[model samples]
Target chain A: MSILAIQNLYVSFLENTVVKNVSMDIEEKKVTAIMGPSGCGKTTVLRSVNRMHELSAHASVTGKVLLRGEDLYALDAILVRRRIGMVFQRPNPFPTMSIYDNVVAGYLLNGLRLGKPELDNLVEESLSSAALWDEVKDSLRRRGAFLSGGQQQRLCIARALAMRPEILLLDEPTSALDPKATASIEELLVQLKKTVTILLVTHNIAQASRVSDFTAFMYLGELVEFGASAKMFTAPQDKRTEEYLTGKFG
Target chain B: MTFTEAAKTLLWRQSLDKVFFGVICFFSFLSVLPLVLILGYLLVKGVSALNWQFFCRVPQPLGEIGGGIANALLGSLILLAVAFLLAVPLGLLVGIYLAENKKNWLADCARLSVEILQSVPSIVIGLVVYTWLVLPLKTFSALAGGAALALMMLPVSVRSTEETLRLIPLELKEAALALGVPYYRTILRVIVPSGLSGIVTGVLLSLARVAGETAPLLFTAFGNPFLSLALFRPIESLPHLIFYYATSPYAEWHRLAWGASFVLVVGVLFLNLTAKFLTRRWRVRF
Candidate 1:
């Protein structure tokens, strides 16, 4: 069953509409990839899911995003964000925090207090889930900035997972990493989808095909095509989706 | 051009660069010469006056051989403490607001105000504080002196805090927000801590700048002779003591003035060095 649904979403910055009448349904515990060229508003769609779009001063949204059949717009934006965590394009672990502190930053920032053992368990579990536990367990007290780029990204993932959000929204998270780092993060995402629903925005068609169960191709501000990844890759219904898949144009 | 000719031109340019470097180094040394000379002079003249009694005893009568700037030293500390308490919170809040809302009309106004405040003469701030606080109370008091110093401190603290916080990438704040942290918490817990070193450096520098200010305290503090800690009473500060005794005709007072000058300069220098050290040690690298 679909866990999240976007209905007639339109997003605009100032007088320019960037996302127009886009709609999609994200399945539970499954990876959905939104693939499009740069500036096609795929990132905008992902940002809007967690109410992150409101951070931009002139950005406006008109749509109903339903999470578990509840309209997210009607709920508090902060509460909505808590339920749907987001990871950015660049790895940004808090520079002032230790790796252990970074993993539990969400709780600390939210003013939630857990007992020391509870926090320890949460940190170990989350890091393990992000596949960074063994690499950082001995050095958890070190600042997160000391980690390599790939390790920092995994630390960010662990931080997000510690909150135990129902959905994870990633905005081209591997774009800033090397090939090996990208491969590791991609593998982590495939593993992550077994526990939490994921909505990934990517420009790489191969990444979408490799990990996404479903693929949505966005062209300009419109949703051009969306279906099972295998079907969409092999037999695209729309001309734009076929062109994008075959590298005719991004 | 021929290769040899080009090589000769390059050689000429390199010689010019060396000349420029020499000139820059000479001028830098020249600029520091006055500070070194003043320190050397003060040490020579003031060292004899500095003793256990110099730190603990109040000034003596004009013909007396020994005296101390105990009251002035204590008063300076008290004024600085009061100024720090007044300035830090207000400066940090204003700075955070300006950094977070760069495009807002209120922030623009505040930025302009900070610039104007920074350029305003310190003596003028003293006069303003005198009129506002001293005149109302009908007395010169340490509170008035501290308020004047706080005014001088605000602009530096606010500007440094804003610039430091602005240098922090927007992604850091976004990272917190994306985790469902509230806006205020994101600023307090993440952004402020990230910029702590710069903020502290600003505060210390501002304190150093005001530590030796005499013109402001001349009207506000009014320079008492006896040691007093009462905030409502007139007080003697290092600069005020130096000004008062240095202008007097007694050889003994002149020696005391030299001693006070030495202490004041050393305190300012210490604050500046501590600021530099803490900035390096506490800097958060992303």
Candidate 2:
């Protein structure tokens, strides 16, 4: 069964329809990739899944999103967000916080003061999982902003994973990293899939195909085609998908 | 040549730029010269006057001179302590309410009233407090002076708290809320702690301003040149004492007033400096 599903999702920006009638399902422990051109509502769809889009004053979304068979749109936003964590395109670790604090920020926010051992284990596990433990362990109390962009991005990912949400939503997680950092994050995501479902948004079909099991092709806020990643890349059913895959158009 | 490049190329001493810069800087220096000279003079005069006995000894009565301002020192401390106790929490809460729950009509009205209260003259505040507190309570007591200083303190504290709270990033609040913490708890735990330093700096800066207030104390804490411990009884304060001795015909009192002025200025300046220094050191890593 699908761990998260969307139906008839319609998002509007002021008077403009950015995403219309978009729907997809993400199976548990699987990586699902959403790919489209810029301003094609790819990030909007990602944000709506976690209800992050509702933060905008002029943006609105309609229809239902179900998480683990429960109606997420009808639930409390705080509850919905707890089960569905997000990482932004930028490395937005709380700048004022330390590396250790950034990893287990979820616990602090929930008022669960972990003992030294518990916090140490949590910081160790999350950082190791995000492939950042080796570099940041010694300087755990150092500010999060002191990390390089790639390291900071991983720390952000580690922060989200610390929440232990059912699924993690990444909005272009590696876009801000260097090629090496990007490759490492891509590798980390491959390992991360065993723990939690990932809904990754990327414009790079190659990266999407490398990391995702399922790929959904969207154009102009509409889902053009979606299926097994290998098939979708090699043999798409729609002309727009073929044009997009072959780099004929954005 | 482009208009911008032409302007840049022609920027020389003969241009209006140099003349304007010199004129503006000259007038600015002129405007600030008095304050600089006064502070310089006070430092030179006061440093020599600050003996241990000057602190330990009590002010000699009327005709007497060359004694410590123990009564004035203790009174200033009491007045400031009481004023801070009254002002801090009340101003902070009102500021937080104005910041967080900016629900159109009510918050707007509250903010507007706070602005008006902040702009009111200290003498008027003294008059108001004297009538309200002293008339009803029957004396220019510590409570009455404290009430006036507290009134002056409110607007500053509120503005500071509001600005500090606003400085906290919105993402931090969202991150807390997303973790299933209630909105109010998130504000109290995350936002408040992060904003604490700036808020404290604001309070200290305002407290320094309040300590220098003479007009409010004129009608409220009027100079009682003796050690006072009772909160409801008449009290001595540095500003009022300084004003009293400065205006008196007695040479002894006049020298004491200048000495007292030196002490008051130094105290306020020291508190303001320490507050800023401590705030810089108290930053949170986590």
The candidate scoring highest on DockQ is: 1
TM-score of 1: 0.98
- Tens-digit lDDT track for model 1 on B1-286? 9999999999999999999999999999999999999999989998878999999999987777887999999999999998898988999999999998898789999999999998999899999999999999999999999999999999989999999999999999999999999999999999999999999999999999999888889899888999999999999999999998999998889989999999999999999999999999999998
As for candidate 2, its clashing pairs are none
True contacts kept of 1: 0.87
Chain A TM-scores, candidates in order: 0.99, 0.97
Q: After superposition, how far is residue B1 of candidate 2 from its true place, in Å?
A: 13
Q: What is the DockQ of each candidate?
A: 0.90, 0.34
- lDDT string for model 2 (B111-194, tens) is 899999999999999999999999998888999999899999999999989887877767677666655567777778778878
By TM-score, who's the top model here?
A: 1
